[model samples]
Target: MLIPAHFEDLPFDPQRPRAPRRQLRLESEGSTASGETARVLIHNISTTGLLIESAVTLAQDERIELALPEVGNTAAHVVWMSESFYGCRFETPLPASALGTLELFSRVISKAAPSESADTLPVRIARLRKEQGLTLEALAALVNVSKPTVWAWEQGKTRPTPERIAALAKLLGVNEDELLSGRDGNALAQALNQARQVVAEAFGVDPARVKVSIEL
Candidate 1:
């Protein structure tokens, strides 16, 4: 039987709590000692370590270098493994500045797990805009709309007309159907639910009584 483990359950000194991990989906590149590179998917990250999934064969205790966006190459060693997923501890914990950059990148690119939420229109718009390195103002200028209007569309406060959506799709390099479908709302909902559960467990309260809210 496969036993599930939480990061908090890992062996550690009781006085020093392990760093919290944030869920994210980021495509990154990793290379082994022999300099063979492979594409890897980052599932979650913390300053101290990361959980990654890759098809490249990796053994426990193997050292690898990961090319992190904005963070440059980081060295890590495999601490544990289950199938294609590997838990790696960084040789040096990420500095605060690098952690900030990684967090920003995560917020920009992290997608909801397919089982948790289908990619929504708002999610797609926000993701594509960030991926293209276009600010709201820049995208608005290209779409001939006010910056707030673009923000409203991304926040699901308002939606563009079919004509505007078609224009947006073209600008975003996707088709109309791809732009209009999939919702980001469910991703937020899932995160909120997870938060509530965690808080409830910490306080020994019912999840229903734990209200969670996120600003932006």
Candidate 2:
């Protein structure tokens, strides 16, 4: 389960140390001048939420879509914002695969090895759906897909289409990226290496940079 210690209505102090910034584009906070897509820089992120720099002014609790690269378009919620930066949380806490993706992009460059056929994506799907208390038939009916299709998805005999991935993410309350990739021990090691930065936080600070109120 995820904790509500994000940048929501919770108590926030703007003196926390944050992870390195990441450059990526995604869809969220509604349509922009260039359509519904918004290109933003991620300041910090965790399993629970992320802090990003965006021009979009998002109201509290506003839900939006994001086309995460490698990952997919996922539903996200705005918890709080200050200046050009906003704190947002995934509708569902991201899975390890999605976290690995974040860890990959947070760096200046990344190289990934091909994965084995015995990937964890299918396992993740099965686990998430069961956690949601939906049987194969029930989930298939909910998504207008056949039971065999759902079974294939769970068995890794096939993968979901982008559109279906979007639907699955929303239906299962997860980030689309979390549904897209699966990894093994190597990916886990990389994620851990990328996440080595320790947080430095306190209550007081100068007004120059955006005060880090929440921990990632």
Return the top candidate by lDDT.
Answer: 1
For model 1, the superposed segments whose C-alpha errors exceed 4 Å read: 1-37, 108-112, 115-216
Q: Tens-digit lDDT track for model 1 on 1-216?
A: 011111111234455454322222232222234333444556567889887656666777866665655667677888987556678999999876766656554443334323124466777888889888899999999988877678667755467888899899889877776678743455657888999999999999999999876565
Local accuracy by lDDT, each model:
0.65, 0.58
What is candidate 2's lDDT per residue for 1-216, written digit by digit as tens?
111111212123354223221223432321234443434556567667776656555667666555554567566777886555567888876665776655544443212211334447787788789989999999999888877678668855468888988999788877777666643445655555434422212324333332234244
| The 10-residue segment with the lowest total lDDT in model 2 | 1-10
What is the alpha-carbon lDDT for the whole of candidate 1?
0.65
* Candidate 2 TM-score over all chains jointly: 0.34
Cα RMSDs, all models: 22.4, 24.5
What TM-score would every model get versus the actual structure?
A: 0.35, 0.34
Cα error, residue 102 of model 1, in Å, equals: 1.6
Residue 184 alpha-carbon offset, candidate 2, angstroms: 16
